[model samples]
Target: MRNIRAIANRELLSLFCSPMGYIVIAFFLALTGVFVIATRSLEPGQPATLRSVFGFMPIMLTIFAPAITMRMLSDEYRTGTIETLMTVPVSDLQVVLGKYFAAFLYYCVMVAGTLIYVLLMLIFGSPDLGSMFTSYIGLLLAGAMFLSVGLFASSLTPNQIVAWVTATIPMILFVFATNWVVSEVDSAPAIREVLQRVNIWKHMELFNRGLLMTESVAFFLATTMLFVFLTIKTVESRRWR
Candidate 1:
């Protein structure tokens, strides 16, 4: 437990000390701000709901998750720091979780940046607090799952760009392709059913509408743990190599 905390602290410090972290935060705020303005979600006399904002979040997370996690392990490998890290008294699971926790904390800050929209809504009109609350829950869970995937991708290669791309492709499939196929194409019912079940956006739909499903929560938690374990295994594989 101590080792985990130490590792998490180290990672967090590294993130805040670097320019990339600030760049990511700025990009996130700018992108979401542009989205809200362009969609007129904050326009006067319009609905006070952030449903449109929530709807666009999966796409934002698909990009930001990889950006935040792409270097967690990959850069350690690139700089030969993994060897030094391994010599420390830490289990692979602890290392993975610690790094993941740090990334999660950073992601939370990114999510909190959206609260400005909520405040704006409160001022302009009455917002549905129930849906807003659930929507945030969904976003947190979704970001956790995506970060785990990115962590696993980072463990696979030393190239940060490669890790970023590897992490992004799966998110693109789940966030974009799944939604498009299920809603747009006249695909087979079986295929559509499968896609809907796997689609992160689909799971978020109910949360955005103030309807919370245990299934959605379970899906995100299960996916996050699955990938975190996978990343631990990937890191452990180096022992055999």
Candidate 2:
């Protein structure tokens, strides 16, 4: 536990000390702000709702989460730091969790920064606080899942570009292809059922609508854990080789 905390602290310090972290945070927040303005979500007399902001977040996360996580393991491998990191007296699981938590925390900070939008809605108009809270929770869970996927991709290669691309392709497919598949496929109930189950956007819609279902929560958590487990395995395999 102590080692994990140390590792997490180290990772967090590395992130905040670097310019890339600031760039990512700024970029994400700016993009969200632009979307909110362009969509007129905050116009005077506009209904107070964060629907526009929430609508843009999944796409933003798909891009920005990969950029944040692309270097988590890829840079270590590229610079031969992974060897020294492995020699430290920490278990692989601890290392993985520490790194994952650091990235997750960074993501949370970015999400939290967008609360300015929420505040704007609150001060200007009457909005449903319950829905807003659930939407934020959904964003956090979805971002964590995206970060886990990015970590797994980073574990696969030393090139950050490759890692970013690898992480992004799956996210894009998960967000866009599921709906396409459902629309294009011949009406096979079993196949559509499975795709809907795996469709991240579909699950996220429930949260966007302020409908908190146990199944949606479980799905994100389970997938995040699976990727984290995969990352640990990948790191352990490299240690052996």
Candidate 3:
């Protein structure tokens, strides 16, 4: 527990100590703001609901999560810090979890900044509190999944750009490939249903409609754990390497 905290703090400080974190945050907010204004002006739905902003998050996360996590292991390897970290009293699991959680938390902060959009919606129109809360829950879960994917990608390479690219590709596939699979398999409703079940878009859509389903929650949690475990394995494999 103590090791995890130490590692988390170290990971977070590394992020804040650099300008990239601020730049990524600023770029995300700017793009999100543009999307909100464009979508709202063209078709002003429920006055100022955060649905539009939150709706855009997966795409943003597809980009931002990779950027944030690109440095997770790659930097340690590049700086010859992995040896020092490995020699520490902490186990591999502890180090992995610490780094993973720290990256996840950072992603959360970026997502949290978008809450200003929710507040803006409240000021202009009456938004459903229950729906809003569920939407946030969905967003948080999705962000966790994204962070895990990015962490796994980071574990595979020592180059941050390579890590970012690897992470971004899978997320892009998840969004587009799922949709494509579903579309091409209309003849196979069972397969289509399964594809949709595995699709983040479907689960996220439920939250957009203000419905919280336990199954969707489970999918995200299970998927996140899968990636986290994969990241752990990837790091541990280095011992044999």
Candidate No. with top TM-score? 2
Give residue 223's lDDT in candidate 3 (0 to 100). Answer: 89
The global C-alpha lDDT for each of the candidates, from Candidate 1 onward, is 0.90, 0.89, 0.84
lDDT by residue (120-162, candidate 1, tens digit) is: 8898889989999999999999999999998999999999999
Best-performing candidate as measured by lDDT? 1
What would you estimate as the lDDT of candidate 1?
0.90
Each prediction's RMSD over C-alphas, in Å, is 1.4, 1.1, 1.7
Q: Indicate whether candidate 1 or candidate 2 has the larger lDDT.
A: 1
TM-score ranking, high to low: 2, 1, 3
Backbone clashes in candidate 3 total: 1
lDDT of 2 by residue, 1-83 (tens): 88888888998999999998899899889888888888898999887887767877777778998998999899989999889
In model 3, the runs with Cα more than 4 Å from the true position are 41-46
- TM-score, model 1 to reference: 0.96
**After superposition, which runs of candidate 1 have C-alpha atoms over 4 Å from their true positions?**
184-187
Residue 198 lDDT in candidate 2:
79
Query: For candidate 3, what is the lDDT?
Result: 0.84
Estimated TM-score for each candidate? 0.96, 0.97, 0.94
lDDT of 1 at 182: 87
What does candidate 3's lDDT look like per residue over 1-241, in tens digits? Answer: 9999999999999888889888988888889889877778224464546676677777778888888889989888788788788777977888889998898888788878877877776766677888889998998899888888988898988899999999998799888899789878878888898898887777888897799999999998998999999988888887776
